[model samples]
Target: MTGQEAEELLREGALTVEGRIPDASNAVLYCSVSHQERSAHCVYKPVEGERPLWDFPDGNLARREVAAYEVSRATGWGLVPPTVLRDGPLGEGMVQLWIEPGHHSDQDDEGDGALLALVEDEEPGPGWKAVGFAQVGPGRTALLVHADDQRLRRLAVLDAVINNGDRKGGHLLTAPQSRLYAIDHGVSFHTENKLRTLLWGWAGEELPEEAVRVLRHLERDLSGDGELAVRLAELLTAPEVDAVRARVAELLRSGRHPVPSGDWPAVPWPPI
Candidate 1:
């Protein structure tokens, strides 16, 4: 289904919880939402199921997830799947269309693996960008690398603007038609800089032209009484909204991808 159609199903359909996702820290439910003749699987995270985090306020992760979707939609990249906040079986929460992982295409750019991989060589060869060295065993280390694909580059830019704090490798999903989607954005949009991620391959590189244009568009959409600004104000604090605007402005000013600040952990633990 198209993004709009999926969004409509999520918002207007009757929802039923199918089962719980066991691996998630917060309660994540596998569900099916149906409206008239259409139906699809979805993931729902209710506000009441959220575990308290020391850094973020309580009962706000669901809103932050939807806020990430709004920014992703504004970029016109569709990096995030269609997501919405509404009352579910558990309560008010974030619900997003489920994307099944597709088979690897014959045209896979990363060649041997998905977006990320580890190699014994210290440097990442062609078609790859080095993240850093990771310890594998007691005395062995492998070079961590990510694909040099434009899609991942755009996601890196998106993570920067959103202040995404936990962009683990597993969050990257390759759906059918080679569409790339990023999920699990609960710890995002903080007023402080907390951009911990595994996609630092483009650190210090000049921003892509498309990304520059997108950032310019975001600047307008986030300034004053712009539509995005108005919508985000309903989901996030005033300072968090301001911080997003500031991040976009900084990207425009720098014209380059950001490097780790060193004040906080650069990569999330267990990067995958």
Candidate 2:
């Protein structure tokens, strides 16, 4: 079916908004049965006429985000699983797996103090590890679900190269066991545009071998009829996939170890 038909399907659901939330776009808590055999956590977005209070220009914002998440899912990366996009009674919507909030240290807060922390960069540790305040729990508190901070750190760097422009601390979630996950990727890989993000601090350094392998595979798959391109096409335009291929090629050719330089946007920026 065409995009319009798909959206029509979403609009037929018995979806309702739970409330408005800050940070994220107009997306709000919504409930509706998803699969015939199961239910899921979902969010709905309405046209501006329906939800003038919501800042998103249209349901396309939700579409952009869901597309980016699919890119990660295509790579077998666990940042976000593929989410179901559909039409709701109110408007277009999505039904996705819900993530429970992890425990936070005393510093984590949800108010203005928390938002301020995101733009305010501070060294979380030595070795160039700067963390966004979102990582800080309520009132600048830290979360206890401590996955390998280093791995998450590396993933953040890759996120930047991929031009994932929405890796805000709030988007990087961890389970109680410290399993890292990233969410909200509405703006990514715009095909030859500056897909720059908050993770630019590692621009001059050699990429981790582990990351390079992933890129290498992606590079090869882009030219063939494989899952990566098929999956990417679901979210990105044909040109966007070409752009991703170019970026991966450029990075792989550098043959350098990971390091930071002034040329990149900024290290430890909130959404790198």
Candidate 3:
């Protein structure tokens, strides 16, 4: 379905809580949403149910989720699923269309094998770059893995621009036709330098030509009176939106993947 259609359904649909996502830090409900003839399975995070963080202000996570979608669209990558801010059964919140994984063709069989195998190994093989190690046992038993997909590389750039602070492994969803979707962006767009992610595999590498082109387009769009800048102002603080513009400019100047900062944790906990 088109993004506009999906967004409309998300905005207007009647939501019924189906279940809760186990082990999620905050309350996340799996909901069945229906709007007239259109029906969709979605995830809803009510603002009233959020677990407050020390850094982020209270009750703004839902807006941040929607703002992340706006940045995704402005970048022209469509990396984030269609998301909208609306009132749900619980309260005001963010609603996003659910994407199911493992619906690929034979062409993706090889890549799937690589991904599954890498998850179990202690080191990444060729065509992959190890980002961090995950402790699976008590004594130095860490599992090493990497993300080798080009789409994820693009998403890394997106996370950088948005200052995403909690890009956990489970937030990356796989959809049909080998498409990857980034979710759980409630902690994004902070004015502080808080880009925690596991997508540092391409650090120090030159940005691909396609990424450069998209960054240039986004930089232009975020300029004064542009659609992206205007939309962001409605969802984020002035300083937060300005920080996004600054990130874009810095990315364009560097023309390469950003190195990890020593001040913050480069990888999120429970690296997928």
Candidate 4:
């Protein structure tokens, strides 16, 4: 389905909870949303079910999730799934179109081996970029690596722009057609520098030409009185929204991907 149609179903459809997603920190409900004859699977995250984070404000993660979708939409990369914020069976929450696994699940090593790997060798080899060294077992260390694929590179840029704090490996989803989708964006759009991800392979590298062009467009769209700027003001705090613009400007000025600030851990825990 098209993004617009999926969004419409997510926003206006009747959501029937199918089950709960296991092992998630917050409540993640697997459901099917239907509007008349059209129906699709979706994930719902209610605001009331959110766990308190010392760093982020309470009860706003749902909005942030929607906000992330907005920014993703603006980028024209469609890196994030079609998402919306509306009332759900639990309460007000973030609803997103469910992405069916393509040939592999998120942790399917057989398929995603090229996208991410723990290499015995020190270097990442050709077509791969080293994230950093990781401790795999007792006294055994391996180099954490990710593919140099353009899709992940674009997502890395999006992560930087949103100040994404938790870009875990499990958060990366592959759709039926091999489309890449990044979910769990509740910790994004922070006023502070909170970018954390495994896709740091391109750190300090020059921005791709396409990414530069997209950033330029974002810089314009996020400026004063712009549609995106106005929309974000509703979903995030004024300072947080301003910080997004600042981040875009910084990316444009540097013309290179961002490096970790070293104030916090560069990669999320359980980096797989």
Candidate 5:
């Protein structure tokens, strides 16, 4: 469903704005929760629309993002906060746990150092502010100052198997604590061109011990008899999951987790 639909469906106490809807976010919104749940400082995102150059259908990316996030979370990436595809005052909008440092939470311990490093990233260039946590690599002249080089690399390997395409820099978020979190899974899963990302350098390299642990866990869940695969089957097609498995098998076959070569579509265009 579209963001507006989300607004309308779950609009019990959802907030809205007169005209201050963010660019591209078609609807204006605010927090609807009464209790001190995850959305303590919730800010609503109305589905304005997508910009040019993507050519995707309306709200397709957002909807898929929520679904993929479910898959990712079930696979052991607790980075994403719980989200709901609910009906809001405007329409069907996806409400998620806000990431901002809030009253109950100080900062994610793992997030602080990482964010400090990103803010102090003069080694690459100026204005490379750590926007989000996905894959923020350097351009032809820029240095990829994304925090924890290996961490993102490992996630990318897992992402390839899952066929996550929109793991760009903006999709990754960093709280003041340095803990890295990924967002926006609307473009995940195996599609014709669902590999848009930045962390492709360690393609053939060994998946780290920490990462391997997570992979092993996910592998078990995707054992064709497990629930995650079954859930994906309901949300996605068998061929899509098969393609992802094929990519995973290829990565496992080759020992090298090589990095990116700055290729087309492999690295997101415009480098945002």
Candidate 6:
């Protein structure tokens, strides 16, 4: 669906709470969203239901979620699911299209196996990068891997540009056609250096040509009077928006995947 259609549905849809997603840090609900005749399965996180975080401002997570989608769309990567901020049964919140795993295509039969293998460390062979080792069972050590998909690599670049602070393995979702979607972006776009992710495989490597092209476009879009800058101003502080512009500029200048700065934890806790 087009981003505009998704946004309209999320804004005008009737949301019915199906249930709570167990173990979610915040009160995330499984919901069915309908607008007119169109309906979509969605995940909703109400602002009131958000757990207080020492770092992020209260009542702002929902906006941040929408901001992430905007940035993803601005980059033309479509890394994030369609998301919108609106009032829900629990009050104002963020609603995002739910992506189901195991969706397949005629061209790729691997389905969600590649993603699962990355998380489960079940012989995620070539085209995957092992970031660290995990204890899977008694006396058994398993490798923690990330898919080497170009789309995911672009997402890694996007994460750096946004200063994503929580990019755990669980946040990566596999959609149909083997597309990877990044979620739970409420802790992103901090002015400070707060990037934490599982995609360090391409560190210090030159960004692929397509990624560089996207960054160049993003740099232009973050400048004055650009659509991205205007939209971000509504969701983020002026200084935060400037920081995003700075990040885009930095990426365009560096032309390579960034290495960890060593100030903060390089990876989020509980990688998966």
Estimate the TM-score of every prediction.
0.96, 0.65, 0.91, 0.96, 0.64, 0.90
Cα lDDT of model 4 by residue, 147-219, tens digit:
7788889999999999999998877876544577888899999898989999899999999999999999999
RMSD of 3: 2.8
Model 3 ranges off by over 4 Å: 101-111, 114-123, 138-143
What pairs collide in candidate 6? Answer: none
What candidate 5 gets wrong by more than 4 Å, as runs, is: 1-21, 25-30, 35-59, 101-140, 255-263
Ranking by lDDT: 1, 4, 6, 3, 5, 2
Encode model 2's per-residue lDDT on 1-272: one tens digit a residue.
23333333334434545555455444566454433333444544443313332323333545555665555554555566345566555545554445555522211223111211232333433333333235444566441121224445456545644566445545655554445556655555655333334443444656677777777776767767777677677755677677777777777888443343335443334332
- Clashing residue pairs in candidate 4 are none
| Residue range 1-272, candidate 5, lDDT tens digits | 33333323333444443343343324434464532221133334434443322644555444454556555576565556555565545556555555553211112345333322233333434322232233345632324544335446555665666666666555565554444566656556645536666555455557676665655666666677777667666555677666655655555555445344344356565444
Model 3: per-residue lDDT, tens digit, 103-172? 3211242355333223466677776777766666676554455547787789989999999998766677
Top candidate (lDDT): 1
Candidate 4, residue 149: Cα displacement in angstroms equals: 0.3
* Local distance difference test, candidate 4: 0.90
- Mind sharing the TM-score for model 1? 0.96
**Tens-place lDDT digits, model 6, residues 2-96:** 77888788889999999999998899999999999888889999998888899888889888889999999998889899998889999989999
Model 4 residue 226 CA deviation (Å) reads 1.6
- What's model 2's TM-score? 0.65
Q: Pick the winner on lDDT between candidates 2 and 3.
A: 3
The lDDT for every candidate, in the order shown, is 0.91, 0.50, 0.83, 0.90, 0.51, 0.83
Better of 2 and 4 by TM-score: 4
Worst 10 residues of 5 by lDDT: 100-109
